[model samples]
Target: MRTYQLYLIDDEFASHYFGKERMVYQLFKDYKEAVGEYKKILEKQIDFILKPIQEIKIHQFISQYLQKNKDFYTNNGLYYLEIGKRSTAKLEIHERCLMLKANGNYEAETIFFEVLRKTESSFIAIDLEHQRCGWLKPIKERKFV
Candidate 1:
């Protein structure tokens, strides 16, 4: 499981630095505490960004905040991997799901995995065929004609 931290970013300060760097006012582990302080800052009309972050390899934390399932983002659903014609689908394993940057392929087979756990970027799934568990993300490139 990954730990989360909230950061208060100063957009005005970052603008001076060419937007490549941001000035963080503070880091808080508690969401409510951060939000409470965030509200206070908001009342002052100051520019800042408050967000909860997990240390994914690439930062993809642009999702709505939910009170429940803070540890891991919950998005329970089925994941389907459709192998293209003359192509393959595969499942790759890593120390963490965030580290996976590519999708796997299997030849001539359509695989369905029941999603046991879901996050913003990846899914913890069990393969129905081999009864194996691994990290997977749903593919959105397929189109139905």
Candidate 2:
């Protein structure tokens, strides 16, 4: 199944669904499209606030990343954050990726890159953003039955 999620760019930025929804980034077709439209609002800014969203293809087993530090994929706000806190990073899942939100949105890709730094070329991490099908493994290892 293909769905959309949002990782707030700033940790201090009041999360829209925090507490009420620990994982506020729900998985649904409408939410996905809504996020796409929301992303546009952030794009209009000349300076930019939210981090670029990474496309996670849970069904296809494919994932996307920023590829560069502080680099993002779109101006759209949905893929990014709502811009409540302009200078924080939140929502990084990987243990090594943990950092103060004062830095910026601690996103999945951040963890992905962090993992790459700590592990061998073969190590891999399943984008936990998927919720149901997420794990970290090495490229050389095959655990799937």
Candidate 3:
């Protein structure tokens, strides 16, 4: 049986929940406490930390999964792939409209919209004069059409 572990960290507190085992481990009250527990676990279970599993953004997971694997409502269109050590891919403007048109799959659309909204919110939160006019302009201009 496949098992999954969910580590929740909020306000420096940490809690671990195991899906298959149906076990909850509240190991720490803060990051400091969590670090101590992690160190202790590291001595015995170093292999567990190196396991391969998908780490996804909560908002983008659904759309990403569907798009990549199932091709759910995804049309043949140009997409933007960020270049760097930590690269990211995003649908272009035409791709966005195609996704919007495919309302038949509401779940995928909903997830994509949520991801879009979050990205837009973060972009809007930036300092306009410094970030938008200076840094973002060149990046936006370089975007793939």
Which one wins on TM-score?
Answer: 3
RMSD of every candidate to native, in Å, equals 16.8, 17.2, 18.4
Error of 1 at 107 (Å): 26
User: lDDT: which is higher, 1 or 2?
Assistant: 2
Worst 10 residues of 1 by lDDT: 21-30
List per-prediction Cα lDDT, in the order shown. 0.28, 0.30, 0.28
Q: Write the per-residue lDDT of candidate 2 for residues 19-108, one digit (tens) a residue.
A: 323232232222334557565543443113233322232211112333243433233222222234433323222222221122434454
- Candidate number with the higher lDDT (2 or 3): 2
TM-score of 2: 0.21
| Worst-scoring 10-residue span by lDDT in model 3 | 132-141
Each model's total of backbone clashes: 7, 13, 0
Across 31-119, the per-residue lDDT of candidate 1 in tens digits comes to: 22456767665534422332222334222221222222222222332112333433322222222321111133442122212221233
TM-score of each: 0.18, 0.21, 0.22
**Displacement of the residue 138 alpha carbon in candidate 3, Å:** 28
Q: Over 4 Å off in model 3, which ranges? A: 1-75, 78-99, 122-145
CA lDDT for candidate 2: 0.30
lDDT string for model 3 (17-82, tens) is 212111112221222244576656743342232222222343254456445543333345433332
Candidate 3 backbone collisions, by pair: none
